[model samples]
Target: MDMGRYLFRQVRGSDAAAIYELAVANEYHSDNLPLNRSLIKAYVQRSVKDFAIISSSGVCKNPLYMFVLEDTYTRTVVGVSQIKNILWRLLYQLRLDPFLGENIGKLALKKEDGTWELGGLLLSKEVRGGKLGKLLSYGRLAYLMSKGLAPRMLISGFLKNTFWEYIAIRIGVSKEYNPDKHWRSFKTLTKFMGLLPAHILLAETGIAFGYFEDLFKIPIPIKPESEPARKLLVDMGLCFLKEIEANGILWHGAPWKVIRDDNFMRYKVPQDTIEVDTCKTSCHLDIGMAVLPSDDFRAQYIPVAKLEDGRVYISKKDFSCGKPKHLFIFETKNV
Candidate 1:
């Protein structure tokens, strides 16, 4: 899927400066990100190193990719998403198997097996409410699936939100949750409040309240209202399990979602049916972006070329530019 106006590419060392600008913009919404210029530079460097050779092999194995979306016309870096092929070591150390056994039903995410984490997705507001998001999501899967590198399972953590709640209802995740399980299992309050003195906490509630009044104000285990999680569920067969994981947080208190890889084959759009010369139907649309009548053909990415047969398409060759070499495209609207 080509993002009509924007092209997605792996981050290069040179992209650090531009990505930093984008990162800082997201920093304004503290929940979105908190990267300073230096961390942003290191992030780009890590991404470049992680995917340097394997990404182009049509499969990225034992991989990680930090993708940057560039405005084809403006040439500015506008959006980004990150994917990692393996779950990090920290999850095991956190000791959350009981949570998974109790809340996640039959599925389990293991450290040794191939599991991929999809996150670090940020799209500029201009591209937020449309197909751009889906292209980035499905395109990665398309790439992974094609290379036979698709994980045995998929996992992601998100800030709890109305969209997550909606996904829960739509996918049969129960809402009969204690909700306090988040705070009890995670110990979020004690960890964050560790900044304050022990004596202040050991004192009477009255004294503790007086000494650290502000800390008590914020609610723990923030419920997230994510529209994006719904799109992920559709494209990747993911569901919001009640279990919250510490691998990543949407803000400070996001929950995790998981599903088996077999679900991808079960749920994927049958791309083999669509006949568009320049497009593959496997590229899914955003949640609710689908038109009612199946015959309707709305353009997601207007191809750079319409063949003599009137087939509209943008091929992998077209996405190559100086800054963006190997690519995927995602845009809010026709450019």
Candidate 2:
């Protein structure tokens, strides 16, 4: 068996090829996502350049990011999620023709209070609902915490007619809002977008392709449905936000929900492996970082430490922003 280990890192331009494959898989099931080979390639290049500049120079930061789940042994990109330091809302004037004037939406993140949003949680068949999801999701939070950009609330939207959206509606954290006044057009667009080849669709848009892609990011409205999951969020103290939602043709129908829990950070950080003794020349943690137990009892990100005299040693504290820095990868057979 080829040994493999999982890792979370800032995406680079070189990852475009691998990530394109992953995006294809995601677009296969979720038709509303406006990701194509050309767009993803562009996304990779743009994001890599931006992250490098941000990571090193801290200038002209876009605050728009995509994090990938990698299998180091195979050198494959398995999954991806997007993060934004701001949320842009579409603002359009209801004109003589609603569709014609739909061009007035903020294509930038919200700058007030510096609220960050987490979206685009796409995982591979091998990792969805598994430990990798937790690691990837929490990893974003960890990175944000390190940069002191952690938001008091993390916001996201679920697509219509999905199990995840079903649960979200039930939890009462979000409600569905639809814009375009004529939701019929909106429905037709989503329904038909997935029916055709992605490349053809992109070509059809011509110079307007980028703008179309941004519109796809907006969450469509979903009807409120009751479910047991709603009670759990209520118990956890999560509340729905009536004000400050994405306003425009972009997210007219999706109910924007917010979660507030100071205690939620505990679950996003790897408390078990984030600490290491810096006093010794070298020290060994029982397991290297991110070597957590998966949902099916399989080990994800299993770390391999060289054992001399059956001991592990390391020097320097493994922490950033007062929290444990996450593990990248280690050789292992687990996948």
- Kindly provide the TM-score of model 2 when superposed on the true structure, using C-alpha atoms: 0.50
User: lDDT per model, in order?
Assistant: 0.43, 0.42
Residue-pair clashes per candidate, as listed? 9, 19
List, residue by residue over 1-335, the lDDT tens digit for candidate 2: 12126766667677777766776765532222235666667766776665665657475445667778778777887877666654343212222226553333222223434455555556677655444665555556555544545454554433333422332344343334223222235443343322322211011121111112222343333323212223323333444332212221112111122232343332333345444345432233323334223211112333233343333333344321233233433222222
Cα-lDDT of candidate 2: 0.42
TM-score of 1: 0.53
Ten-residue stretch with the least lDDT total in model 1? 200-209
lDDT of 1 by residue, 270-294 (tens): 3232222333433423221111111
RMSD of model 2 against the true structure: 14.3
Q: What is the TM-score of each candidate against the true structure?
A: 0.53, 0.50
Poorest 10 consecutive residues by lDDT, candidate 2: 200-209
